[model samples]
Target: MKKIVSLYSVAILLIIGSCSTNPFTGKKTLALVSNDQLFPMAFQQYGQFLTENKVVVGTAEAKRVEKVGMKIKAAAERWLTANGQAAVLQGYQWEYKLVDNKEVNAWCMPGGKIVFYTGILPITNDEATMAAVMGHEVAHALASHGAQRMSAGMLQQAGAVAVSVGTQNQSAEKQQMWMQAFGLGSQFGVMLPFSRDHESEADMIGLTLMAVAGYDPKNAVIVWERMSAKGGGQAPPEFMSTHPSNETRIAKITSQIPAAKAEAAKFGVVFK
Candidate 1:
C-alpha cells in the first residue's frame, strides 16, 4: 500500500509539474518531454528517414508541396503573433520535404519538420486542398501533440508499474488477469480517446490556419471527403480507433467552419 501510494504521488507530481499551455487553444497540456529534448531527436530521425527514402526534388509536385508548406508556416506565424504567442515557436527550425512513397500520408514532426508522400498528391491535388492537409499536420506540431503523447505514454507505464506492485502478493493467475484488464482499460479508455481528441483539435486549428492562409476553409471538408472516399469506409469503430471516424471528422469540421472563417476574417482573409 505504501509503495502504491508513493507511485501515485510521483505520477501526480509529474503531471502537475510537466505541463505547458497550448498556444492555439489556450489549454494546459502535458509536456513531460520539452521541445529542447524532443526536437533534436525528431530532427535526427527526420534526417535519417530522408536519407533512407527517395526525396523528390525539382518536380512540379515537389515544388507545390514546399510552396503550400511555407504558406502554412507563415499562417501559423501570423496567428501566433496576433495572439501574442509568437515565443511558442522560437526554437522551431522549419523544413518541408516531399518524399517518393506510395503511402497516402503526410506528417509534421516536432519543431516543424514536415514530409509529404507523393501518394497523397491525388487527394491533395490543388493548392487549397494541399493547404488543408498541411495545416492539419502542422497543427499537430504547433499544438505539441507529440510531446503530449510521450508524456501520456510515460504516465501509462507508471500506471502499469503501480498495478504490478499492488498485485505482487496476489496469485499469478490473478495478477495476469489484473494486468490484462489494466492494459485494455488504459488503451481503450485513456489512450484512444486522447489520440482522437488530438485529431479533432488539429482539425479545428487546421481549418482556421488554412483560412488564415487565404485558402477556403470549406475546401477542408472536401479534402476529408476525398479521404473518406479513398479509404472506402474501411476503418475501425471510433471508440477503438486512434483517429475519429471519417463521418465524425467531417461532421465536426463542417460545424467548425463558420468559426474558422471568422477567425480568418480578423486577419483580413475573407472567403465567399
Candidate 2:
C-alpha cells in the first residue's frame, strides 16, 4: 500500500512539474519532453525519411506543396505575432516536401517539417483545398501535438506500472485480468479521447491560419467532405479512433468558419 501511494505521489509531482501552456489555446499542456530535446531528433528523422523515399522535386505539384506550406507557415507567424505569442515559434526550422507515395495523408513533424503524399493531391484538387490540408498539418506541429502525445504516452506507462504494482499480490489470473482491464480502459477511455481533442483543436487552429493566409475557410469543410466520401464509410467509431468522425469534423468546421473569418479580418483578409 505504501509503495503504491509513493508511486502515485511521484506521478502527480511529475505532472505538476512538467507542464507548459499552449500559446494558441492558452491551456496548460503536458511537456514531459521539451522542444529542445524533440526537435533535433525530429529533424534527423525527417532527413532520413526524405533520403529513403522518392521525394518529387522540380515538378509543378511539388512546387505547389512548398508554396502552400510557406503560406501556412506565414499565417501561423502572423497569428502568433498578433496575439503577442511570437516567441512560441522560436527555434522552428520549417521545411516542406512532397513525397511520391500513394497514401492519402499529410503530416507535420515537430519544428515544422512537413510532407504531403501524392495520393492526397487528387482529393485536394486545388490550392484552396490543399491549403486546408496544409493548415491542418501545420497546426499539429504548432500546437505541439507530438510532444503532448509523447507526454501522454509516458503517463499511460506510469499508470500501467502503478496498476501492476497494486496488483502484485493478487493471483496470476486475477493479475492478468486487472492488467487487461487497465489496458482497455486507458486506451478507450483516456488515450483515444485525448487524441480526438487534439484533432479538433488542430481543426480550429488550421481553419484560422488558412483563413488568415487568404484561403477561404469554407474550403476546409469541402476538403473534409471529399475526405469523408473517399473513406466510403469505413472509419471506425469516434470513440475507438484517434480522429473525430468525418461528419463531426465537417459540422465542427462549418460552425467555426464565422469565427475564423473574423480572426482573418484582423489581418485584413475578408471572406464573402
Candidate 3:
C-alpha cells in the first residue's frame, strides 16, 4: 500500500511539474520530455528514414510537396509570431521530402521534418489540398503532441507497475487479473481518447494554418471529402480508433471554416 501511494504521488508530481500550455489551444499539456531532448532523436530518426526510403527529388510532384510544405511552415511562423509564441518553434529544423511509396499518407516528425508519400498526391491533386494536409501534419509537431504522447505512455507504464506492486500480496490469479484490467483500462479509456483529441486539435489548427498560408479554408472540407471517398472500406468504431470518424471530421471542419478565415484575415490573407 505504501509503494502504491508513493507511486501515485510521484506520478502526480511529474504531471504537475511537466505541464506546458499549448500556444494554439492555450490548453495545458503534459510535456515530461523536453523538445531539447526529443528533437535530436526525432531528427536522427528522420534521417534514418530518408536513408532507407526512395526519396523522389527533382520532379514536379516533389517540388510541389516542398512548395506546399514551405508555405505551411511560413504561415505557422507568421501566426506564432503574431500570437507571441514564436519561441515555441525555435528548435525546428524544417525539411520536406517526397518518398516513392504507395501508401497514401504524410507525416511531420518533431522539429519540423516532414515526409509525403507519393501515393497521397493523387488525393491532394492541387496546391490548396496539399496545403490542407501539410498544415495538419505540421500542427501535430507544433502542438508537441509527440512529447505529450510519450509522457502519457510513461504514466500508463507507471500505473501498470503500481498495479503489480499493489497486488503482490494477493493471490497470483488475482494479480494477473488486475494486470489485464489495467492494460485494457489504460489503452481504451485513456490512451485512445487522448490520441483522438490530438487528431481533432490538429484538424482545428490545420484549418487556420492553411487559411493563413493563402489556401481557401473551405478546401479543407473538400480535402477530407476526397479522403473519405477514397476510403471505400469501413473503419473501426470511433471509440476504438485514433481519429475521429469521417463524418465527424467533415462537420467540424465545415463549421470552423468561418473562424479560420477570420484568423487568416488578421495576417492580411483574405479568401474570396
Candidate 4:
C-alpha cells in the first residue's frame, strides 16, 4: 500500500512539473516538453517543411503573408517585452511563408514560423481581415496549443500504462476495453475541450492584436460569419466541433469589442 501511494505521488509531481503557465491567461497549461527542448525540434521541422514544399518567394501573396505576420509578431514582441518575458523567444527564428495551397487555412509553428495558404485570401478579403486570421494563428503559437496537445497525449499514454500495470492480472479483453475507453475518454474530454479553449483564447488575443496593429476588430466577427457559412450546410455544431463559430462566439466578440477598441487606442489605432 505504501509503495502504491509513493508511485501515485510521483505521478502527480510529474504531471505538475510538465505544465507551464500562460502569461496572457494566467492559466496553468500542459507542456510536457519545455521550449528549450521543443523549439529546436519545431524550428528544424519548419525548415525541412519549407524546403520540401513549393515555398513562394518574392510574390504578391508571399509579401502579404510576411507583412501581416511581421505586424502580428511585432505586436506580440511588444506585449511580451512589456511583460518582461523577452527570454521566451530567445532562439525564435521568425519566418512567414505563403505557400501556394488552396486549403483556406493558415498555421504558426512554435518559435515564430508561420504559413498562410493562398486560397484563404478570398475570405480574408482585405488587410484587416488578413490581420485577424494571422493574429489568430500567431496566438495559437503563443498559447502553445501544439505543445499542450502533445503533453495531453503523453499523459493519456502514461495513464493507460499505469492502469494496465495495476490490472495486469485481469483478462486481456478487459484490459483492451479499458485502454479503448481511456483513449476515447481522453480525446473527448481533455483533448477536444482544451483545443476549443485554445481557439477561443486565440480569437480573443488575436482580436486585440489585430486591433492594435491598426486593423478593425469588427472584421473578426465577419471572418467568423464567413467561416460558419463554410460549414457546407452540415457541421457538428460549434460546441461539438474543434473550431467554433456559432452565434455564441460572435456574441462574445461583440461583447469584447469595447476592450479591443481600447487596446487599439494604445497603439494609435482608430478603425476606418
Task: Find the number of clashing residue pairs for candidate 4.
Answer: 0
* Candidates 3 and 4 compared by lDDT, better number: 3
- Looking at candidate 1, the ten consecutive residues that score lowest on lDDT are 1-10
- lDDT value, residue 121 of candidate 4: 80
Residue clash pairs of candidate 3: none
lDDT agreement with native, every candidate: 0.94, 0.93, 0.93, 0.79
Candidate 3 C-alpha lDDT tens digits along 1-272 = 68888999999998999999999989999999999999999999999999999999999999999999999999999999999999998899999999999998999898899999999999888999999899999999999999999999999999999999999999999999999999999999999999999999999999999999999988889888888898974778999998888889999999999999999999898878
Clashes of 2: 0
Q: Please, what are the lDDT tens digits per residue for candidate 4 over residues 5-68?
A: 4556777898887778886677898878877787899999998988888888897767887898
Error of 4 at 197 (Å): 0.8
Expressed as tens digits, the lDDT of each residue in 1-272 for candidate 2 is: 46667898999999999999988899999999999999999999999999999999999999999999999999999999989999999889999899999999999899999999999999887889999999999999989999999999998999889888988998999989988998999999999999999999999999999999999999999899999999999999899999999999999999999999999999999989
Model 2 TM-score, 2 decimals: 0.98
User: Which candidate, 1 or 4, has the higher TM-score?
Assistant: 1
How would you encode candidate 1's per-residue C-alpha lDDT over 235-267 as one tens digit per residue? 888999999998998999999999999999999
Q: What CA RMSD would you report for each candidate?
A: 0.9, 1.0, 1.0, 2.3
TM-scores of all candidate predictions against the true structure: 0.98, 0.98, 0.97, 0.90
Error at 186, model 2, angstroms: 0.8
